[model samples]
Target: MRGFRRGLHRRSLYHRSLHLPPSPDAAHAQLLALHESGDANAAARFLREKTAAGSIFPGFLSSVVIDRACKSGDLRGALLILATMLHSGTPPPNQHAFASLIDALSKSTRLADAARALELMRDAGIHPDVVTFTVMIRGFCKNRMMERAWEIFQEMIKSNRCQPDCFLYGVLIDGYCKELRMDRALELLREMRVERRIQPDVVIYNSIVDGLCRSNRFLEAWKFLDETMVLQGCSPTVVTYTSLIRGACKAKKMKLAVRIWNAMLERKIQPTIVSYSVIIDGLSKAGRVYDAYRVVREMETLGCELNVVIYTTLIDGLCKSGFLDDAYALYRIMKRSGAFPNQRTYATLIDTFCRNDRTETALGLFDHIRDYCPLDVAMYTAVVSGLCRERRLDDARALFREMRLAGVSADTHAYNVLLHGAFRSERPEEAFRILEELGDDPGCVANLLTYNTVIAGCCLESGMVLFYEMRQRGIAPDFATYSALIDRLLGSGEIGRAFDLCEEMLASGLSPPSGVLGRVVARLCWSRRGDLAAKVIEMAMAVDDTASFSLPWDDEDGAAQDEDSQGEELGSIKDGATQEEPVP
Candidate 1:
């Protein structure tokens, strides 16, 4: 038995040598070693040389090297290796080499190469197997080339050489689901069971259920869970229930999540760590932070040890809901419970405290993270923004300067946040300076939102001058600029000037916002330009009546009215106006 085992091992090593042949058997051994060590290029070179000497490299070794390269996301390298192997007088092309290449190319996102590989396989007189077709299907799915994938699938069925397996069915069905083509997903599901006579396994059912849930077809998903799984005596596993819970949470069906949770508990379906994390995340996202905490406590009571993810989720949820104090408390508790915070946890805390204008606290937290978890730009930005929000512009500016000294260039969002803080803190000049700095940097130009923000800030105190400066600097004004101008003019009771600007905006080929126009109308009415106000109202009506006046003043009354009555009148006016506009 020992001699047989040694012989088997020798055969295994020699089989690997055919794909990567060196000068001598010893060199071949070295080449095989490299291939075994995951060096696809060396293997390809060696195989090519071996084939040139009229030696046919073993099909399995070629497959192994190709597979390793493909799985490692080096499809291009794998292709080059295959080409080398082909040049070497290796055995004529076969299904395994071609099929493996196709799968590799597809996984590498080289869709065109994948298709070519498939064609090459067919040309070499090797019909692709189910694995080949399935691989191509997955590639098409990834590229959103669903039509092409389906075409290949049909061909696979037509050949009838290899039956479609559950894995193949799962890929196609899931692909349809991903595209939100629930109808097609369902059709595939039914066909697989009825026409194809293949039993849908847990993966198949999970794919369908998940697809349905993701599409927000909860009722249908539940029906599948109830009828298909339970009625068919196919017990649903943790993945199915977890997906359902997560989906229900995303759909904001808290009640349904509770029901699923209870059912899982009763069935003794031991929830994985991921299941607990999903539920905790769901609860937190729903703003039921307290309920989320309750879940954590329950896990502890049930002796289900919580992971760091659960603590982070709880802290993040508390912080998002303006419960910074509570988040801090949770952080303390998390430490006491012996789960050390990760970088993400520290980032969340720093960001939360900073956003809530707790710059000191945020800074302290950042300092702690800097000592433990590595701090990133987000951490600094949060603290900077917080400082700015608290009117501590000096501290914010100092932080920015420090970030620069540390070789950290500001991202667009970080710069915009700082600019806003400066603008709000009565430092529009500083805000303008920041914009000038940003304009000099080409990397910050894609997001027009940042431009809008800075421009809007310029509209604050004598901000019109800055707007003119922006125009002179060749920066095009977006709808946001017009919106800001309209808002500023309306607030200052400069109705006539605001209307003139609106006209200019229209002349510039800008799309008019009904909301802004409606505000203009209200301002005109306040200025007692009843005729123009009525005209503006008509224009507003032309665009959207649903946004018509919600106030009692019309083009006359300037004083405040009862909130309830005014709200009702506004609703009535809007509803009446909506009924009049054509759908086009």
Candidate 2:
């Protein structure tokens, strides 16, 4: 009764198709359903049970199941199914199905599995079809395994079972082109024409041209394009012209691209969105925003509506040109025109706002995104970093917590914000606790900022003892770490100790910034050790030939220091009298 009930429950979940089709059809449908539902085990079980029940299993179904399992990356399951089909006296289907299995294995990107499938096909007395050869060749070429693909092609030719058609040649040409093996693609093309008696089509021609263009051989690609135009039976498609224009644009030969674009117009061929976007992106990247804008106007004139990507390009251009207000206005225009802002839009806005010191505006925009839109971790991190820079630690912490609650895993940048906030609140123990909490996250260990922030905190609150502890924990100190140590030592009036750190920085090939070196000089000057002070000034001059030092004095402090100095080596030069450096 329990078994019947379980069967009923399982039946309830399947289709109620009254007439049973062939076992292969039903099995194919069930397998497809299982794969769709992500129930690989159930799919496998259905195939086993039906075959065992003496159902008529077709060879094609077995081939498909094998292909399905291979493509799904379940090699063991595929082997089990293959064994069951073999035992059931089902012959492996037509050459097409066997080829499909090979294609599936190749698409899975498992070269060993593909090789094994190919071997199994040969052993079963099923020869690989043309599609099989093409797919395997393309797959090997994609992985830069050209040698293997070439060997298979040679073997296929030697077997004389199938002829290499135009499609096959196209596949190999495209594959080699994609791998940047232009020489191989060209050689294959030449062989196709002269040796194999196969003619070049637009696709084969385009593949060679595109490959040459990608290798920065625009001149070669162009020369080939002209050669293809004059080929006896080949005619250039719109795609051919677009490919040349795009290649020229990529090589930043805008004049050539424009000429091709005009030629395409003369031929009455329409430009695709990809072509427009490519030119617009290139124009914007090259700081030719005016040209990019002109393209947008041209697109409008051509009755092609501006897309979000086009507007984003315009916004980026405006922002780069120091027109943030204009960028913002264009952003508003983009929304009004029914283009939704994607993650890049948000990131650009946040970066622009922060750079303009409009931190509140950036945070407000971020807050809205946190409540709505699919959240991007990078966008959140950028905002968190801006808040930390602005010293709004509490707000930064709240956002960090919100990100975790939203099911976004806290990356190292988020952790850095929390550590910075903890330090801002003067809770070194809390900061240390955060680092301890991150011990389980392997990704956190690779974050240099996280390591630097925590190391800097240790140097500030605890000292080198914790700094060494951080090192023991496998956190390597960066330049910021050394700078923090120098800062802490200098703050404590340990100039000699600070000099040791300076030496360490120099040994590590880190030259402290001029501003930081200025601070060190100021510290020495205030110490009244005139000899050491002169040495620091001379060192600073040697490092920066253009730098000149002038002692800045406040009128009040100047009067006080002049009144107090009896001798250069006076112990406790009387606090009210010693010259204090003017605060900027």
Candidate 3:
């Protein structure tokens, strides 16, 4: 029967049923061509018109069209075709047809629609098989709707329509693991193993192991792999070791990661490119660029083809470690090796160049990649920040406009960068303009950083006004906000106001920056407000005994000598010396 069906599919069933006189073979060929050419719309339109015109499509042909639509990411169109097939009743929709549609819809996050399609399949007297239910379960788990997924699993078991399998258990376990619900995931794993007698596969073990690592339960992960996995006869794959390496890197346990890498090699499991990439990235981020390069060389020696991602990781690591020339040299090597640098590679190099006072070089790189690569906000932010750091406000402004013109809207970070630069460059007017621009756009709500940046730029009076305005907008002042205001007040000689701000800072349970506090105390003492300075120091120490106060008067005996000097200064003010001479 299968051979007969294949023969029928091979031969054109009909040639001239509709206005168009093309055979089914010719129509199918045209549809496939359209799909391959990336014109899914034309393909869908052609299918819909043929179906609407009473053209009889073979069951195989309908399934082909449906599969193509789903593969093209046209879930809506695929569902429509399925609906048309069911309505026509010429070629009844099979499990494969419904499964394709259900899988696509579920993956697309239209879970409810996928459920509806499942009901339609059942109503048409086609019972959904295990694959159908698995797809739905995976979709729900992926969407983080664990409750719904559990209900589906329960229904599958209770209804006896299809026995729950290891794959189903694996899906739910992975979902729980991803949500950091390791306990539930383990519970399910136990139930699958002991109760259902389903041996957990490597995939399930990998999921739980990865979950343990990600949740920082590395000890348990290690124990499970060493003891439980060995007893259960499940061998750890490269993915399992890679997960361990990644988790170790995240926890900054590079020594442990290296040990795991060695163990993987001892087991004779060849490391995949991803495993190499993980180690390289981890080492590079840990300031071990030379070690990362050695791994790259080792990978090449083992005859592993170097890809763009590995090169990009090394480039970024070198850039971060302040080896711009080395990073650029590798980049040139990568290009010569026929591996193109991606946006991240370009962004990393550009950011590094800008940081090292090489804005022009950064700009040149940006211009070179602008036409080829779609510039993301991070790339634009890097250039704008670098230009701002260079105090090239005009050039920064031009680039900001260019970013918008490129259809990439500036995020809050981008705006914050510009606002901070404007304030740092003493362009108060430009900072205010940015605030106004943020206000005009509903999407760009001013965050605390925006307010803090403006306050950091303003004088005492202007800053105070902005602070009150920030409060009126119900934006609470954070540590940065309070610090900025207090620092400005102290610099402007508003000693009393600075103290009041300190009181607010204490009330909010935020300790002022130690350096700023020290400077304020020194300034007060220099201005002959020695009594007030002592009081402020005592207040800060009372609030936080760990607070270190730097006094203008230094003594060799440290605490004892400083205390004696403070007492003498306080007594001098109390003894009718209403004013003391300012320190020259």
Candidate 4:
């Protein structure tokens, strides 16, 4: 027996000396190592060169290569590998290999390519299984293409290749809930329970509960939790409670939010960092910062380390509540606790200081953090807007140029800020130059706010021209746009044109600003168009029955005068006016 064993070992060594290929597991490990080191292309090249030299790579190894390429976001490269596998046919690829490619393509929003990959899979004599169809359906749902997702779901069932599992039903239900199609979601739940006889899991219950809460049907959510979830032996998780808490906070029912929080604790469902963050943010926004702080303290006491998000939430609450000193102190604490402030934390501090007229401090903080965190558009816009508010247009313009040089493109909001600042500083020429620059930039499409700001700065004719230009650009005028134009026309004593604009504004389902309407009525009464003024008031009241108009007109006696006579005259005009001279 010993001699036989010795002979077998000697034969194995001799076979190794012939330079025989390594095992498939060893080859796969080499490819995975290459992928881990971020040299997936090198692995692919090695596989190709070896295969070209008559070396055979097993199907599983080939699948690993494809998976690596897809994970690296090189879907095209992965598909090429799949094509090579198809033609080479050393060992045929399996369902998992194509599934990897399909999943990656779906995640990248390349749904068309993903569908083609499925066709390729079929052409390669491989039918898609449950996992493949599930991935495709999820991709469609993520892209908000619900109809396509349903088609894929139906295809999976119609093919009878695999039955719809619990996970598949959960994905479709979640999708419907997210789209606010609660009716369809519940229908699926009913089918799962009655026809399929699949007991709804915790995940399915969570989706339904979250959907109901988001739709502000809190009572229904609670009823489902009590009747369906609890009765069906499905226990509520932290996510369910957190969803309820979020809904309560959004609806400004903090007392109910606290009750939900307590219920979660009573059930021994430990709050996650996300749950804690949501409650903290809600409390802060509700002006209950002290309560938020108490929760933070409780978290620390429970040995749950607070993250940067929690600290930032608290700091924002402090800043907005006019406790800048406290906010900065918290910032120091955050840094000391080994939690660095993110861009939002820095932006809040800088904006608060600037609002308090401490431009130098805000600038200093901005400069200190410029190299630490990547400065985003919001931070730059905040400082630019702050400088503009301080009437330091030159400094603001310099920073704007610096922002451009830094490759942070200025959006419409940034331009609007500078334009408004110029107008406020009585720099019409500079404002017009900004407008021209906006028109010249191909990347900067003017939005409604942009036109509104310019109209607010320009005179009546220029503003009217800009309005027409806005329409030509396919940008519909919003309420603010009409408000600015109507205010400008009424201020220039163009009552007829102002009334025409107001009528258009009403037709667009937007009410003019009450202040602007009051001004128009006062101007009409002052110009002895009392009949037109009364008609304007009537139209305003028609649009909103509870609308109130304050007339600031006075007689020569220096006392406020009643406009009852104006209403009487308005009635007479309405009775005798020609069709050409309409109420507007």
- The TM-scores of all predictions, comma-separated, are 0.58, 0.54, 0.65, 0.67
TM-score of 2: 0.54
Residue 314 displacement (Å), model 2: 3.6
lDDT of 3 by residue, 198-290 (tens): 999999999999999999987678788877886788888999999988987886667556657766665667789999999889889988887
Rank all candidate structures by their lDDT, best first, as comma-separated numbers. 3, 4, 1, 2
Comparison by lDDT, 1 against 2, better one: 1
Order of the predicted models by TM-score, top scorer first: 4, 3, 1, 2
lDDT of 1: 0.73
Model 2, residue pairs in steric clash: none
For model 4, residues 193-308, the per-residue Cα lDDT tens digits are 99999888999999998988888876678778888888999888899888878876776656556656665665556789999998888788878788788788877877889889
Q: Alpha carbon lDDT of residue 359, candidate 3?
A: 89
Error of 3 at 115 (Å): 6.0
TM-score of 3: 0.65
Error of 3 at 52 (Å): 1.8
Tens digits of per-residue lDDT for model 2, 1-584 = 99669656654444442246655456555655665476665666677677766765556545556666666666666667666666777675556655665676677687777777777778778888888888878778778787888888999999999999899899888888988988888888888889989887878887887888888887677766665544555666677776776786676655445556655655556667776777677667656777777778877876889887778778877887778998999999999999888888888888778767888899899878866677777778778777777777677767877877887787776677778767876777877777776776665653667767766776555657666666787766666777788888898888988776765555554545766666776787787755665665565556444333222231433433122212222111112122332211
Instruction: Put down candidate 1 lDDT per residue, 1-584, tens digits, no spaces.
Output: 99669758866877676666454565456556778777777676676566666666556556666776666766666777667665664554456667777877777688888898888777656788888888888999977778998998998889888889889999888889889898898899889889988888888788878888888876677778877777767778888998898887876666456557666665567778898898889878877777777777767866788779998998899888888788889889888989998877887987887776666877876776676766667777878878888888888989888987887777888788888888789888888788777778665642556656765776555557656766777777776888897788878777788888776665565667668877887777777888987765555445444433343222233333222211111111112222211100
lDDT pick, better of 2 and 4: 4
